[model samples]
Target: MLAFDISGSMLKIANDFLSTKASCNILLYQGDCTQLFPLRSNSLEGILSISVIQWLSEDSQIESFFKECYRCLQMNSTAVFQFYPNSPEHADQFVTVANTTGFHSYLIMDMPHKTPQ
Candidate 1:
């Protein structure tokens, strides 16, 4: 099963991804991902998010989002989130927010990619 949030061009990108993958249940959220309510608590094993959370600019919203994420995950579950930081400071802020919400801080990998045009 997969949970995805999409709007605009991302919806199309996600559609393209789904077209090539093995069949699995997919839930697409069209609005703000911060409003999502995860169903079947502790049921999801691997959660992946990419280049999304960077859009949130306010501390309160980030706090709420992290709280929700923590609530939605089961013990020992892993979430891999990749986001583009506005700057070094922004990256630090992201870490502070994630750790405050109870994630064990780990910088898994950092790679370079040209920003999409």
Candidate 2:
């Protein structure tokens, strides 16, 4: 497994935690998710991000990030990102960008009762 974070401190904390409990060989790196990842095209089976995508404040950055994800993932693979959009328009932007980047996107609201802030 490969994991990365923009924060060196976060990576260190993850490394310290994973070293004791993780069963698999997990490689960790410190890098910006909005930039190109140190990976080859069509190399990854899947990608998962938790509360990360919303940090990209610009449309180009989001588009670039999605494009990079699409480039790295294998055909028919999925990249699931869990994030809280600031508003409905923000959520729509994510879906729109994902679709524009050649991904068949879906938005699954975990809590339908509570509206997005």
Estimate, for each residue in 1-117, the C-alpha lDDT of model 2 and write its tens digit.
788789999999989998898485889999988889899999999999888898999999999999999999999888998999988889999999999999999998877457678
For model 1 the local lDDT of residue 79 reads 82
The prediction achieving the highest lDDT against the true structure is 2
The TM-scores of all predictions, comma-separated, are 0.76, 0.92
Clashes of 1: 0
**Poorest stretch of ten by lDDT in candidate 1:** 105-114
Top TM-score model? 2
Per-residue C-alpha lDDT of model 1 across residues 26-105, encoded as one tens digit per residue: 76556566765555656667668788779889988777777677777899988877888877778788789989998875
- lDDT (0 to 1) per candidate: 0.74, 0.90
